[model samples]
Target: MDNSSSSNITSSPTELDLDNLRAIKVLGKGAMGTVFLAHHASTDPSALSPFALKVVDKSLSFAADADRRARWEISVLSRFRLHDPLHPFLPSLLGSSETADILCWAVPYCPGGDLNVLRHRQNDSVFSPAVIRFYLAEIILALEHLHGLGIVYRDLKPENILIQQSGHVTLTDFDLSRSLTPKKTVDPLPVCSDPETDFVPSRTFTRFVCPRKKKSVTNQKGLRKAKSARVSPVSRRNPGSFYERSNSFVGTEEYVSPEVVRGDGHEFSVDWWALGVLCYEMLYGKTPFRGKNRKDTFKRILMMQPEFMGKPNALTDLIGKLLEKDPTRRLGYRRGASEIKEHEFFRGLRWDLLTEVVRPPFLPSKDETELTEEVKKGGIDIREYFDKLKAPSSPLWSPSLDEQRHNVSLTEF
Candidate 1:
């Protein structure tokens, strides 16, 4: 064979360069992708370690805007690890590249797996109050980072929350997220010259007011120059409105914010809504608002009837504020995250002291390395591992109509 002019291909079949990396094993399979575990040989070879590399089929990028999505994901992940300065909690983006139609991005492997897995592995055992507070505090810190950068994390669930050995929680999956600047108000409402002539008493506001909280005033005159600075003066609704009524739905049915369910364009409040749902799940083993069908679930959300069974008063109060059907009355929006932190559940927590607090309440299984070793020695049985971590059965676990729509018929994928 003429070596230089040979038409022959390499003997190995597209094997990843295990020289700079090592022992690539499939972590999970998805519709269009698979994740792998490989050591970082590109860095200091002497360093003992490996990393998680998420690889996606390039053909999956055949859509018109696939490249744009890929680039956006890469951009977002690159900065994910450094979001929180004081108590930064995110996966470090090691490196990324493309070969053929495969897109590969690497991050530090989370040994403890995710919250979903933990919840399943330890069924019926609720996270300690300290752990819950720490995890939620980390979540809020992460949200503050993304929100500050104008990004909206539309998807918030246990599956997307990864727990590191250090007990820090990192939010993942940016597919449904987008940058949000306050939507510019359209056609400002005409300013009133004479209040008595132009003022029309708001019927909607009547039901929400507390007569005893204020004076015995029938028609509270002299409306302030700005009723609610947070709300747009030109929006169809007045300031301090709960949820803007509209008709559109975007988000997981169980976790979708009220405004989003109603089709009104959502704002930061949506994050708060999802956070409430997460908080509910944290305290209780399941979501507060759930139903046998999609329609039923929607009804429950509208009713905002989440049962507070066997819940601590502090925890119930937190959930109550979060699950408020009216967004305006929600916990965080009223007094900001401060109120949430101040709740009795988090009484002794010191935000400023987090930096000095070297360790977290939970840690990854110490046998993680042994598990990996077994995989290398024989073969990695990821399916069996995850099967053992399946979520517990609950009456609320029925697949909704929308869930059925996207449900995979077979488990092969």
Candidate 2:
């Protein structure tokens, strides 16, 4: 964030004393690394700019490509700093620091947490259509900017989308993102679902007619809402997990794109497919192509199509176009997000005014101005904490975030 500066200290990657930083609390802990809310030890902890510090233990045996992935993410964050007026929906690198035992970087802390946690707080674990549109619009712009820079965000799950204090969002965790040179543009292919008017060549899944199980509704005549899905953008892995065998695949299972699943090459279009899945999930409270397990899930993603309940609508139509199994014909494949922005569903949207919107659908109630008890008490010393961790006899007691909000599957390494 431009407002908060960790630049002076982190810009220079050198060993520091115990007096430089204070760890507020463990924001999250995973196999790859741990995230901490930290403020400068030099200032009044309560009235200073705090940042989320993602520390990757260089010594972890299971974190394959730990240094590379961490550096890639930092490099990507570094790239963000170069943009004149940074994209409102993307994160900025506060700064970065690395020592012999750990690699850590800083970014603005998102008080509202991730999208999945927000969705779970909703009445039925789903967003209203209006709220869905607002969030999806922001996410689209974020992806649009990333894709514009030739960086493909392979992982577009709710877990990576964070709501800012201003109620806008910033896409986080770029470790899975890859830079791809887009294919040369051709005359955009026109895909028609009707068999009589179909012009798509080498069709794999033109129209999936498989029946879907519908929920009992109070008003039986009501149509259901749209939901979302993705492919590619593989995540890193730890050793000896149940899904260690499928290291060949990438991206989260439920959101992965069809081309990625089939070993076909993918580019920017994969993110668009994931956007569709996100929309579907926000509207319907579930992903469109989920099955019993990883194998069955990939099968459904390949052979089946998402089904809609009640009547077809503009949102559903957009989702359908995005979910096209053929990557060549999927919406935004050739034209990028401009193609998606032009869909009937987003006909009148003002892209330029997105950041200006004051009241977003969701906002973080946690006041950053007021320091929490952990922060007030001058919490753990980061240097000492790492020093202890570097010891062979360091205690093992790190907990994962709430299981309900996190979808843990190492199927894609």
Candidate 3:
């Protein structure tokens, strides 16, 4: 129960000692690793300060990729700590621990769970325009900060957006992100006097704009092969140079941009495209272009348009512009987030006063926090718990069943 905060804003990240942690319950699991609700073992268990610990088991068969992604996520989180004035919506690396068999890191816990869970709690499983606007704005600012640091966040979905104690949102899961240099433009040349005529040419000469190379749909099918042979997902290319494209075929199927699906290479605008899909899902309770299978989904993303349920409005209009098939034509492509901030959908928003809003659309109750506390007191060792579960003889635990039982007696927030 050493309650000392491991988060230091002034220095590089240091590995945390695992002996001080106590696991409460499992939060979630993914291809990368498992997350646990944990707190300082020496601190009072009932104290309201807890953090989420993500642990990657190095003993697993797929440990190499998992370990690489874990380290990448840690690097991304470390960047936020180095900022002079930290961005409010990005997670800070609270601590990290590395052992021969495991790699663990901690971030402040978001008791309200992820946005997907929150949306399911609503009456119709959809958020209203007001709520969507509030959440979208915060996400935009977070992406803006990441883009400024030459990072492209490839994954953008409801499950990655977590709600903090104050009801503000913080984005999570940065392992899929890639660092890219912003596209650079050459300066126009000045006109000079002609050698014989001694006359200056007209100043209105137009510079020829080079068109971006297009990849055929047939060739795009081999994008994965092309990428694997050329560069790794976690590439160490010169990020400070003018190159701005990533050929890595990464990102969730439903939220992947048209450019990504076509293997045309992607830059920062891909996040804006995913933002549109997110906004649509928040309002409609489902993604617009999802299909029966991965191939079908990619086809729909490239060839189909988002169908509107009713008459179009400012919000829908914004979504339409952001989802433009051509990345160059996307709403935020040229000017970045400033173009999105000026959209009519966000008109009259007091961006500066967003954090000061006393009440948000929803807030987690005291009972939920208490439920988390009760689970932690069950006396299960965090590392040993996962190891035991993985044994052939151990009974498989169903988190869904536990969630169902917990929900039975709970009141709606």
Candidate 4:
């Protein structure tokens, strides 16, 4: 816990008093808690600005873990708020508070929505190379800053990459992230002088596209019915290590690294593996190593290589290097993000000037930035909202819905 960076944070009030805060709408609901579109109750309700408040209801069965994660996220955000000068791409803690039955923290709202939703809005449900490059560069810089602080962002996916009002990307969800102490180690692989000739292979690899299956009426109905009944996968407990390797099998199923799935110790390299999966998903429409279910997905992650659909290119080459099974041999393992920054795919990228870039791929509509008229009429107490939802007659706490709510996926929020 270093507080040296505390002096540098001046953009927003460092401490938010929950008594003055009001919830506008439910932004999302996840495993840890719910995120609400909130603002200071005294502030103009019609104002364009509002922040997101993540609240953990402590009366729930899993309140302890959720409380710990909420606090951890606050700590992580505090560090970024005090130390990181680049606020455009990282979340800053506007305020945080706790009560006997609740814990809550607020962050600047990202109106552009998460990358997953934005990608779905695209015509082909995928981004062009240029858009991917822009977004990836911002993400790389954010990861670089986190690594510099000795933190490992184990969760890196489209869902966590949020778009700012300026349309640039900002990463969210630090609950799954862990702080690690980096040990000095020698690079096992030598740096190549000629990146162009050293990395590119002569043979072009072709990937087969799996055909989409048509769903029968009964199958479609079953899927629709199952949507509300699906349960979240079991969460992995923290290994509670600081300087040494972490052995916890934590991460989303599709984006998890090979080492994580094998239950072998993991460090910062896991993020690079996830970056490869994200890049592949951005290029094509889905994850490369996905299988039928969780078991099959994990097995493929350990034994299968990422399948690419196009001919050999700098982007594909970068993906291949990042997806390397050996953590040490991975593209960013040794030098961290510096190695990936120098890759041929990002050869001409001006990493230093990333924040100055104007006109990002998409700008959020005005409706996203302002509270709806209907929402403006009501001022809901954050704690009372959850308490009411958990009451006996409430739909959220009903016997049948209790299991579903308890097992809700983390992505829903």
Candidate 5:
């Protein structure tokens, strides 16, 4: 019931219906719902523009929770004026609607897919320094806008960063975001456990290498295997203030911050930590601290330092500061995006003229839509898809707010 939409959609600009959409294919599926690449059925069958449609089933066993999250995302998007563009990197809610058993919304289809997909296609499954700089600037501006609106984007993995037709990035999947009132008061007191103490004991803290990298290291003894950091963990004492701290634990496993991992109340600094992880992955082709399992991954996040390959530079230095275990000490911890934008890595970059850049690292052509023969003649009825769910299906997985892992996990698009 909390749904509203913008009429600025480039394709229709009018309230569309399930009847008007021909689902070309499933774009991706997430914890709460599935997204489809759909075009207006009334348009030329091979129209250049098609939007992404997200469909959520509100009749499942977890409908109450699903509906609440779906509505929350809708409300958040309602804040952005899509047509005029409050921030270019952020997405606009093109249109939305819900029925007695189904809830749905539309956003502009991102033809370039997600950052994760794009990263895999690169030469080393990684980006160059210039490319990383360009993308990070846009993503940083997006986070800045969201934080300015008092919204904490709990989820910040590469999968949620989508590339628009214009080659600029737009963040998607807001169901995991939390609305907080920015409290300028002093740092929050830690509860339950000190994240600093969550570090693995020195002797047992085996070298936590990113599973993807083949890089190796050795100590003075010339031993290459099973080496771990003796470096002191960053102090947990936060120097910066924050919005009201949230006790709710939610986020992607690899990107979750030290505070959230330790059950300490968290605030906006969590996003900064994730930005660090994002940068590390962009430069090195892998997340810095991924381990065998979620628990191990989180342990590495709380304990180990990121291993910077090759000679360290401004970019690596920026990543190190951002990945500081102490959220208070992290880059952009207090003053937000300004702290990040001023980093040496972004030097000489015109923050205001990002949109005017004629060539992005990658440009998705208008004909990027690779419609199959089935897609060309294609038809899938959304209403019929949900209507067919009269019988019980598998319960959709939702992340536990208590920080416990369920048997199921699904990402949001």
Candidate 6:
């Protein structure tokens, strides 16, 4: 983490040799970053070729500290390189490096921007149930791989899943991802080891609880006890480093899992809970338990009440089981994915067959035939907009660690 070189990484693609890849355009922009659509520098367009490249903006941070934060992001993404070759659903890693203002990592480019963008543009905002299940199955396999390696993808929103031109799905954005292993080391290093203490209860919980609790309970002495009993502060330190928590709000409120919202310790089951939320959204065009505000949203999530309107009975049942407020009663029931797969919703799902199922219900339109017409029509040119984003003169733009550690918004995304 001390290597300053990584923090001030150069964004110049000169080192990356993009000669192998051609920039098509930008995908989308967010507070912290932008995405681009790049093709393999060497490819025969007429024949099958290498996948597209995903270039993430490392310039989202504001200063040296933001640069340091970018380094942490780099560390998180680097972990994916360790994925087992045999893993069915893990995305292929192409290459990674630090840029002055962006941390460039190349991976198989997914042509589809994200499920959210796709659905939002659709009139119905819903996908076929079979198609949704197909993607879920892949995600389950990916989640299993992440959990096996101690990583947790805290942000599981539809925006993070990309549908490829070939109709396969790939997970992206490790900025919010983390390891489940405590940072503490059994064998101490010369420096103090980061204990597993940096556990993020999950952004899923931020909008649900006030972190601090107080009540007016009175004792038999007819005297009120201290209005606020002392409770351990949720550790905000990233057990590994003295840096403050990186995200103010943990998970998107609409899709937060119960255990995360309640601040009860959570394990990998939280991811499953998010998957359930995603499935529900995919089928219904909205969250099953949305509220007008954070308070109401938390109430619904904590109460475990979701109105499954018009969803298939199988999906409905699966969502119900996964959304259980009590983690103990969650679908895995501590047995893990085995129970999930065994559920009636997944009765016909063949884990092995599902991975190789190449025909997805949805895919990106690849015929460039309409490209010129749209350009002349003054329609959105997402690709060029993204490519034109100025390389930041400073480190990426990240909220102060304090902003991330505290002041989590209860309503905003």
lDDT of each: 0.55, 0.69, 0.73, 0.72, 0.70, 0.55
Candidate 4: residue 53 Cα off by (Å):
0.4
**lDDT, candidate 6, 1-413, per-residue tens:** 23234322233222444434444444544433444445443453322343434444543334444445445455554555554453545555555554444455555667676777787776687877666777787787778667656666677878778776766677766555555554432221121112333322322211211232232234312311221221113222121121122223356677776666765555566677888889889888888778777778878888857786663587788988888776555665344565576555554344554544445566678866544343334432333333454545533333422122122233344
Question: What would the TM-scores of all predictions be?
Answer: 0.67, 0.77, 0.78, 0.78, 0.77, 0.65
**Candidate 5 wrong stretches, greater than 4 Å:** 1-15, 43-46, 82-84, 185-240, 372-376, 387-413
Model 5 weakest lDDT span, ten residues long: 202-211
Clash totals, every prediction: 6, 16, 4, 0, 0, 32
Q: What tens digits encode model 1's per-residue C-alpha lDDT throughout 29-121?
A: 433245666664455342246667665555443322334444455566655544444336655566776655445566677777777667666
lDDT of 4 at 355: 69
The pairs that clash in candidate 4 are none
- 1-413: candidate 5 lDDT, tens digit per residue: 12213211233234657677778776766667768788777774664577888888887777776667777787677677643656788877777776677777888888888888789899989998888888898898889888877778878878889998777899998877877765554332222122332333221111211122222234323421211221123223433234567777788788888988787878788899989999999888888888988778878988999998899898999999999998766777745787787566775555666776656777776654366554666657777765664545624333322233222123221
- For all the candidates, what are their Cα RMSDs to the real structure? 14.0, 12.3, 14.2, 13.4, 12.8, 13.9
Between candidates 2 and 5, the one scoring higher on lDDT is 5
Tally clashes: model 2.
16
Q: Which stretches of candidate 4 lie over 4 Å from their true place?
A: 1-13, 185-243, 368-370, 392-413
TM-score, cand. 3 vs. native = 0.78
State residue 376's C-alpha deviation in candidate 2, in Å.
2.7
* Model 3 per-residue lDDT at 137: 86
Roughly what TM-score does model 5 have, to 2 decimal places?
Answer: 0.77
Worst 10 residues of 2 by lDDT: 235-244
Q: Could you tell me how far off, in angstroms, the CA of residue 208 lies in candidate 2 after the best superposition?
A: 36
> lDDT tens digits, residues 237-280, model 3?
43212346887777777888888777777888889999999999
Highest lDDT against the true fold, candidate? 3
TM-score of 6: 0.65
Alpha carbon lDDT at 12, candidate 3? 35
